[model samples]
Target: MNSDYRKPLPGASMQGEPVDFFDARQAVEDISPGAYAKLPYTSRVLAEQLVRRCEPKLLRDALTQLIERRRDLDFPWYPARVVCHDILGQTALVDLAGLRDAIAERGGDPARVNPVVPTQLIVDHSLAVEHNGDDANAFEKNREVEERRNDDRFHFINWTKLAFKNVDVIPPGNGIMHQINLEKMSPVVQCRRLDSGAKVAFPDTCVGTDSHTPMVDALGVISIGVGGLEAESVMLGRASMMRLPDIVGVELSGRLAPGVTGTDMVLAITEFLRRERVVGAYLEFFGEGADALGIGDRATISNMTPEYGASAAMFYIDDQTIEYLKLTGRDDEQVALVETYARHTGLWADDLDTAEYERVLRFDLSSVTRTLAGPSNPHAHLPTSELARRGIAVDYPRAQQDEQAGR
Candidate 1:
């Protein structure tokens, strides 16, 4: 905290103490002159997190490795929080309780075992798709079935709310976790008070128990979906170790063809990227095409990151993200904070136009047409007009005739 970059924030917390932060922009400039500006937004964010969170002695080595793109060295990533849907989220909670019980049996302190970091458990997966559509009593009926079937899981979840120190649960019948995160939970930039009595501001990042957790990444938050085990590990204060992922720039140009929804664009892009074998890379969307896309459109692509085998699909912090924050009813002060932080930290969209990548993929949005993904695989984009050619249409009369003749 003795560096030139460590600056105090302009507020007093509930404890009335001045908050401070390690200025990531300054750290990048000090460690490697002019390099921060060259990093893609994702790299810039990762650098900032490492600067603020890593030990000072080890900081130089990690910073150097990141700037030089040394994939061999792994660094620590401490997420701001964890998000979980009931399916895997419940499993993780049950595992934690089991861990506590095992510790107690061994005479270790059971109460000491709690999720150190904030954990949000949304009961989004409880309803069966069995009762979907048009029925006025559908939700009521599904709730009954969900409660009856998942009574034991629900009991554990309720206990976790009271038993764990930093656990919050959203009862069933709420929307999906990813949707909730996009609309409300993720702040893009988080300002919080530390136990050390200093409040700090940093980019909002998280790991979810489902693969589509990266949906919030469309808003320039770094969220990844992880397994329940990994979520538990992070929950217990373990740093998630990761090699710097390959940051691939995807340059988009041309407006979407008329009638081509964001879904069509994503399906086309998914198919293209999948064939290009973009596994393990962070896909950064940019160019005029990217700027033209709405946050809703961007979220569509980010949500499909896992299907294409990418680690994260990210959109740079731009006016679009700020507009989205406003439209979602975020407080004016928070929106101001997001813009100020992003602009100053070299994470904004305009700051990235000159950023270079080791590899680049070009896609023209005009090439996309209105299309639907598969009846099964999401990447299988079959145009409605081509369905007959693909033999997806059944000869209903022929089938009925065959059935009547007992053939």
Candidate 2:
């Protein structure tokens, strides 16, 4: 939004004072009174980011493109942040360090080079399983192995902590990066002070180095995974330019039957979505089935988004989200902010019944049974009873003979 169109946040401030922000609600309302809430969660987050940062010349076109679902026109999106596990994070930092040396060699101020946005790396990728699960000291033993095995890499990671700005490192054995993000790193709503002395409230949108990054999207964040090179570009404040994706509304109805866990449901849904050729689509799940699921249940589905080849799997913020925040030990005030911001910005699940999608597929959770996924493909749904037919329960000697005969 232009300066002339900016409005103050009702309960937000930079320093105990009111703050002005680009009123995304007003912008979409200018398009149509009922337009804002009808946008999919993914689309709403994308629109807000564009409204906040897109150039004046390109702003209207971009917003119109998204509002109308014009897949023909491409647009630019600036993620609020970037997340990474040690494997990619370490490499990116090393590249930056190398770049710094190259700059110094060119008589430039090497120290001036740093990430322009918030970047966090968790040392989650490597750890030796030196202790078995039955051991009482398993976690400690694992940590010991991790520290010893990754001594050199950890040294470099520690150096980067002091060597660079706008970077935070979470030590190994903390948890998986996706789990850490879900449990702590990601704030469902982000509040930041902009250069104009305004504190803006927006979704916690991000891109990670692992595809399962969408796990946080269950909390209403617009998170997705990108490769290291792409992640590096985003870390340096580059816009992720792209054409609009096919946003598929997956209307989940009915409840899961007895013995049908959330995992079974996800496997079933993944198989269903994959079969529908939902590759690269943004999937938004709604209806009584989706609403009945807790945040953890939603996370199980979102975490496996890549398994079905979809770009993101998102659930709109709702009471489950609020309850989850409190259960996870988030401060009371922060939890309240999430609700207020989501409600006001048209991102709340209750506000999205009218959301529109050109293409849609429906799945019945009740039809989902106790399932076994696969020996290979994640979306390959193999019923436990058919394990033998799928060669998963084959006779050992027969299989060995067949293998020896090169069959």
Candidate 3:
């Protein structure tokens, strides 16, 4: 950690007082004048982690990449936590159990082995709908069926909760992992106390097992999806190595039409971004249209990150983010911390006015109509107005008459 960059955050009352945070903006500006003010929101959060956790000796070069928009060198990213569904989570745990046994055989203390980072495994994917929704007892029936079908797997998952440290499991029927993460798990900003008794705050970031994990990016947390092996590495406290991604700015303008839904806007965006070739880019969405949206609408867009082929879909921290945190029932003190830290550290939306991006794309919300995706591909933007011309919306009676006439 770079103690030189560690500074106290004002107006943040964690335990009746303020807490410390890594001064990432200062660090960036020291290298290049006015560079921090131009960094995208994603880069700012990444820089904070590097400032707080990256070795002091390597800090300057890492911040240089973010400031200068270079990606030639690899830097370290230590995700704050890992989230997973039952299947991949089980696989990673099984691998760890095997490792423990191997260690025991080599005269090592297997009990000492545990996940270094916090992990949450939700048992969401294994349920089979044995009864349809029309049945009032459908949920109960399906849950029963799932319990019976996966008894052994459930037993192992239960045992892991106790046998392993830093492992928490959410049993089946609660909700989908991505939805639960957005509504419940992620705290836009997280706090941890150092051994010296000083508390420090940083953005809540995570890696999840499913692709839809980016759904929580709606909350301004830099959550991303990774495969099981990548998740395991993070779980074991190993840094995910990476060069800076292509951080693209998506400036939204205009208001959505009255009848248009968030789904409509996202479908359109998916197609536009795909066509624009944003694959593997980290996207930061800002502007009047983005500000007009609630978190639910933002989540709708972020949930389809893979459809647009972007690594992440991010929104800036602003009043909308604060409101959503309150709506989701986050702690008042934590909420205050989020606002205070962001404003003080140049993470607020207002602070981003001068921010620059390597590439910028403009999207108009009003331009989006009642839209839909392809019959096959998610990015195949299919507006409802085009359905008939595209031969998708057939006249039922005409089709039947044609069939009768063997046309």
Give the winner by lDDT: 3
Candidate 3: RMSD to truth: 3.2
Residues 1-407, candidate 1, lDDT per residue (tens digit)?
A: 23446686544232445546667767777878888777887888888788877877877788887778788788888898999998888888888899999999999999888898799999988778557778888888888999999898899899999998889998888788899999989999888876665677788999999989999989988899899899989998888998889999999999997888888999999999999899988989999999999999999999999999998999998999999999999988788778877776677888887788989999999999878775568888887667667798756787789999999
| Candidate 3 lDDT tens digits, 1-407 | 45778888876768775699988888888889888888899999999999999988898998898988888999999999999999999999999999999999999998888999999999999988879989999999999999999999999999899999999999999999998898888878889888888889998999999998999988888999999999999999999999999999999999999999988888888889988999888899999999999999999999999888888999988999999889889888888999998899988999999889989999999999887765678766678888778898977788899999999
Each candidate's lDDT (Cα)?
0.85, 0.85, 0.90
Instruction: List all candidate RMSDs to the true structure.
Output: 4.9, 5.6, 3.2
Instruction: Compose the digit string of candidate 2's lDDT tens values, residues 344-367.
Output: 778899888888889878998889
For model 3, state the Cα shift of residue 256 in Å. 0.7
| Residue 293 alpha-carbon offset, candidate 3, angstroms | 0.7
The deviation in Å at residue 288 for candidate 2 is 0.6
Worst 10-residue lDDT window for candidate 3 reads 373-382
- Model 2 per-residue lDDT at 159: 92
**Candidate 1 whole-model C-alpha lDDT, 0 to 1:** 0.85
Instruction: Identify the superior model by TM-score, candidate 2 or candidate 3.
Output: 3
Q: What would the TM-scores of all predictions be?
A: 0.89, 0.90, 0.94
Write down the lDDT that model 2 would get: 0.85
